[model samples]
Target: MIGRITNQQQLVSAQRNVQTSRALLSQLQEQAATGRAVTKPSDDPSATASIMRVHAQQRATEQYGTNISDGTAWLATVDDALSSSEDILRKVRDLTLRGANEGTMTPATRSAIAGELEGLKSDLLEKANTTYLGRTVFAGSSSAGTAFAATPAPYTFTGAAGATVQRRINDSETVRVDVDGAAAFGTGTGSVFALIDNIVTDLTAGTDLSARIGQLDTHVSALTTQHGVVGTRYSRLQQAAQSNLTQSTALEAQRAGLEDVDPAKAIIDLKSQEVTYQTALGVTARALQPTLLSYLQ
Candidate 1:
């Protein structure tokens, strides 16, 4: 036999439908107001994970960009110092050429040239011990105040011998920002300071200056080589900065796609859910009303 549907069952079913419709409307309104598809992990676990991953990558790329910037500045400092040193050396070379002309040099002339050469040597020594951000650029890893000793005949390199300063611009990339002071300016008696001192001595003694001139050329050539190395590293750092910018932009786009909502679509959905909820309320009200003819049955 078929069983008759009870009044309690009809009322319970209608109430349940009304509750479900209201819940859906509330959820749609929240989505529209917040402008985010997944405000919580329960909304979409996979998308949340993807957003987190992209966010992590973006943060790392940002740090890499910072490193690249600092590296660029440090390298620029090194380049500037080297450039100044080269200019001074060129002036010294010119003086050497003028003094080597023993055919016309008087004692007073030699003495004057010698004094100027000594000044140039002091300037070069100052450049060799250049500092950046309070640290000597040529000093490697040494915590010493200066890269080279200022006083004494044979200048000794006071900086760390094997220190290599590098900055990580990416997960797999790093660049050295410092040059070897000992390599660029010789250590002990072989240093450029000593070489200039020797040149001054030769000029004072009226000795053959050809050998000293050749040594100056060698020193100038070495500086040129170190300058080239700095240029190369600077170029690489620039490229890495560009790459990091591109990667960060892409990651941000991906993250937006995963978490951000389309306002237009969300608004449309909210309107539809509102209509549905209103209709459910009306139907439930009608279904719950008592009928007059039902008492006679």
Candidate 2:
């Protein structure tokens, strides 16, 4: 069965086509206005998920970078303390060697050596109790204000055995940032402070100081070993920091690729869509124009 086409039906169809074209043009204009390719989840759900994943990776990389920085500071502090203590010990060793010569030393000379040794002990005590941000670096994870106490006759190391402070630089790597106080400067009566006190006493009593030189050598060796370990860890943290920076940069690029739109392409698409919508308007207007023949039909 053939049905006659009506003017009302033709007008309705032309209006619908124009409405659809206008909607497409509006969408393109919005895409150009906002630089983001996927402003809403519905814009590109798959890309949205990928971008979220990239963001998570970026956050993790950033945190790792922070850990590397903190570890570097801790190692540097430990290195400085060890180096200073070593230098002080070397000076004390030289003084001890001079005082051990019984033939050249007068009473005044012996008293002067003892006084100087006492002064060096005070300085060494300060280095032994070195603190970083109100916490002793040698004490590992211990919260004590200082690592060593020199008030009593025999000094004591307050750090706990096997305790350590650590920082995580990445998913697979963790580094220890603090030194062992008892190991670096011996604990209890065998501590470096006690050794210094004994040397000062012997110098005052006119006893030869040659025997104490061997004990002094032991303290110097311990500081040197700990300093080397700190330097090695510092280098490791520096490498980890570089890797974290590279990872962060790559993740940012990936995130931008997934979420951001190229401005030039968006503008070009918007212009093309606008032209298409304008042409549809022109065609719909022409088709809907009233005619004398149409009224007779």
Candidate 3:
């Protein structure tokens, strides 16, 4: 009776060892295959926390990329409007030069140039009222309709004051996305529109206007300077966009490393697990088998 009981105890111990070994081997296989120690909170609390943090960083990076794209588009719209305004100003400058040569142009010729000047002014006003995604690009921070605010009244700046529509490019850095219409075109000390208007008025009255050519030349120079500023800003935005794209790509790669499984590694681990489980089953079966002496007893 003692011998039979000892044998039963030995068999139970062997079975327990096999079960424990199989469980550990299965866990190892899963870790090797998934390249992750935790599939859920129950698997590993610490690893789960690390994964959550990495995921949050990825999400924030994606949002930052979105902001960069939106900011870039806004800057693009502003740059385009400024470029158009430059072209219009160039034409106005040419007309002014022609008007200055009063010896060659008759009064009727001057009047025709004035009409064209008015048309150019209208085109410039349209550019000043340019919008991007429903927001006025030249209105500064004020959302008031009509950037130029022309009421058949000449030489007036009815738009909002100061620079507005700033965009954040980094944690502590922001850039203004708009050039105020008043600063760019309306009547003021540095106003391009007022210069053109003066030239047109002088030409319409059949005035020699030769003295105003120097002032018009200065206006053209200022417009050219502003255009260079806008061009430089556009280049900066392009650089930022490129940097963002690179950062987003790096973040995606890191996220993939954190979450994605390698198929080749998974297949090898699965095969090893199958072998370990089969070995455990064979050993358990042998240990659980009844002996002849047990039956006799």
Candidate 4:
């Protein structure tokens, strides 16, 4: 089908070529101006989907970071309180040793020891009820203002039994941030508060304080062991936080690579497209040049 080539057909084909080149030039200019390779999903659908996935991961990582921070704070408060409680009990043990010694049992000395024991009990109560951000750290999710109630006799634990407060540090890990007040500081007649008061009773009645000294040691040991557990959990949260930070940064870089434009490459492309478009225009103009014999046709 070697048919005659018509002037009208050639003109239409040249115009279509120029329009396509102009459109490509316009697109390159937009990419240069916006500095984004994929302005919309239609520009690069696969890359856009990848960018969306990366963004979702980044958001989850950021929330994990926040949880790690809050969990660390909760553990820190518990650790400090436990340490203070241990120190108070140690001091109580020393005073009991003095009272038990047969050489130093003066009336004045016993009275002073009793008074100081009362003050130490108050301090231990304060530690057991210690709060972090207005919530007791030892309360295990109980909304009570304090972990232990002092107004009622025997000082019952206000926190609920078998309850826990936890934080999700990552996809696979959840950590308990709150300590059990009952486990750490007993309850009712078996409580450390009651223990301190009982020691004062035995001291006032002129009984040997040797047994009270051993009881104080037991409470001290419990506090020390619980503090060690808290330290371990705190360290875990810190590591999780670091890992989250690294993950977030990597995801952000991936997102940028998928969406952001390379300035040098964009400039080179823009110039190349412009040259092609200009050449297309020149050729089309020359090819469609007005002929002197047009009126005869």
* TM-score, one value per model: 0.88, 0.87, 0.80, 0.90
lDDT of 2 by residue, 168-278 (tens): 999999999999988888877898878888888888888878899999999899888888889889989988998998899899888878977799999898888888888
| Alpha carbon lDDT of each predicted model | 0.89, 0.86, 0.72, 0.88
Cα deviation at 163, candidate 2, in Å, is 2.6
- Ten-residue stretch with the least lDDT total in model 4: 288-297
Candidate 3 collision pairs: none
Model 4 CA lDDT for position 139: 84
Show model 2 residue runs off by greater than 4 Å: 1-34, 285-297
Please give the lDDT score for candidate 4: 0.88
lDDT of 3 by residue, 96-185 (tens): 788888788898899899999889988987887888888787777666666766666554565568746766655556666677666566
Q: Report the alpha-carbon TM-score of model 1 versus the true structure.
A: 0.88
Top-down TM-score ranking: 4, 1, 2, 3
Q: Which tens-of-lDDT digit does each residue in 135-174 have in candidate 1? A: 8999987888788895663698998767788999999889
Per-residue error (Å), model 2, residue 256: 1.8
Candidate 3: segments with Cα more than 4 A from true spot: 1-37, 152-163, 188-191, 290-297
Better of 3 and 4 by lDDT: 4
| Model number with the top lDDT | 1
